[model samples]
Target: MSKKKKIAILGCGWVGNALKTKMEEQGHEVNCLCRDINMDSLVGFYNCDALIIAVPPSDEYLDVIEDVYFSVSLNEAINTQMILLSSLSFYDNDKLIADAEELAKIKDENTVILRLGELMGYDRIAGENTAGKMTNDSTTNYVHRDDVIGVIEIIIDKNVRNKIFNVVAPIQSTKKEIFTQNSKKFNFKEPSFSNIIDKNNSYSSDILCDVLGYKFQKENVQDFWS
Candidate 1:
């Protein structure tokens, strides 16, 4: 059995809470931060074996980071090994890469950024609970939440740090393929689609599987819409 490590997750939203629960199940100690910026939390955060920053990027997110981790001494920031949950949609091209490269310097080299595609899982599939995008032939770039948490655990367990990895399923499918196969199970009408123009920033997980050896548990698109 792998040794248990203490982890401090700085966000307690849906993804954060789920990750915390999963990590706890695996025998790792987890501390979840749901309150506003607090120095006491940062003090505790600096002592963890690793940190997972799950807060989505927004106008004030940077400021929040400054309060939460960045404002601390460089030594303290260096001690906080982090796994940032980022979106692949933001870093999809050359120009975007140039911009994101600057944002990367905010954290120390020990931090790993896992860029996720559209999440698929209970109450979170593209075509269900609301609407879907992409055409019949447009390839779907998504991964289940279970796989996302799985990859995160792999990174922590294997000590994979200081890089960006796309946490998407290797399985490929069209929007219609997803809904058509699951229509009976989910009872959703076949939705229309449009030609998905941008593909440069589409999410995939070559580097992650290559580096960390994570096999996606929910590889099929139509396996879990219940």
Candidate 2:
């Protein structure tokens, strides 16, 4: 029988909470870190074994590292392994590699960094940056939230560690292709086509299945709706 591991999650919002519930369902003791002091009720649940950071992308995120908050949060459980839920936003084609590297520099060497791409959903972000820019002529990576959590579970089961990996669909699809697919499913107007790289930076990852043995839930990303 496998021993149950204790897990601590920082910034347990939508994705973080999902991970916590998933891990707990697998018999692991889970703890969460939140900004609010009223969350003290959760402190009794998790001491530490593995720390999973689910914070969003932001300039101030690096400040968490400088503060050694993660390292100190676990207190006596300092030897815990870490899984940083980072984003492709940090990958500014090596320009931000320094910051990216810093985020994974926990005290332990068993840390794994999973950098995700633009997630596609019908939620608020759907109408924001990506949805507005998607075109039949444009090709990009979009991973679903369910797929994101699934890949993480797969990694935990295999005990993959000490590397950087991209959690994206295998096939790249344009915005129009995805939207059209969704429109067909939901019966909406066929979105127009355009070519635009809104962000000044372009980031890409090559090692996912090569190192971690993680295949995304979907092969074709052509059906994603942003």
Candidate 3:
């Protein structure tokens, strides 16, 4: 077993809270920092072995990073490994990419960035949000909540750093395929596809698998209802 270490997760939302439970299950102490909590509380978690920033993108995100850096500096926790949970939007969204790059500047050699695909699992499924507004033929890039947690565990376990990985399932299914399957399984209304040919936004996780030697527990987004 890997040695137990102290971990801190900022932003205890869906992904962050789930990660906290998984880390605690593995016998590591976890500190959860939610948005409602004061940023000053970051001081207490600065000494942890790892600091995971899983907050979604927003105007307040950079402010959170600033506070975290200030607290880290005050505590002089130079060895604290930092991980930023970014999104695949970084491929097209300049602002989000800039935010991720800012986080990477914190500790170049000690930080890892994961640009996640569409987050799916539990209540968040394919075709639920974009129902009648999307093209049926466009390819999907999705990653399950379990796989996200799984990849983070491998990074912490192996002490992987100084890399940015695309955290997506290996499979690429079309919107029609996923929506059709989901409608049948979950009894949701099938999404209507537009006649317009939209650009495929498929992303690959080759670097993640190659570097970490990690296998996804939930490889198919179409099968991720639970």
Best by the lDDT measure: 3
Backbone atom clashes (below 3 Å) for every candidate: 1, 0, 0
**Rank order by TM-score, top first?**
3, 1, 2
How far off is residue 167 in model 3, in Å?
0.5
Worst 10 residues of 3 by lDDT: 34-43
- Residues 1-226 of candidate 3 have per-residue lDDT tens digits of 6899889898899999999999999999998865544453534666778889888777777877767655655656357778888888888766956665666676444678898998988877777666545554678899999999999999999888788899999976887888878877777777777676568678999989998999988887766874
Model 2, runs deviating above 4 Å = 36-46, 68-70, 73-78, 93-100, 106-109, 121-137, 195-206, 223-226
Weakest 10 consecutive residues of candidate 1 by summed lDDT: 93-102
Q: List all candidate RMSDs to the true structure.
A: 3.4, 4.2, 2.3
TM-scores for every candidate against the unseen true structure = 0.82, 0.74, 0.90
Better of 2 and 3 by lDDT: 3
- Candidate 1 per-residue C-alpha lDDT over 52-169 given as tens digits, one digit per residue, 9 for 90 to 100: 8787666666655555555334445345566778777656543443344335546465568887877878776566643343343456777888898888888888887678888877
User: Residue 43 of model 2: what lDDT?
Assistant: 53
List the pairs of residues colliding in candidate 1.
92-201
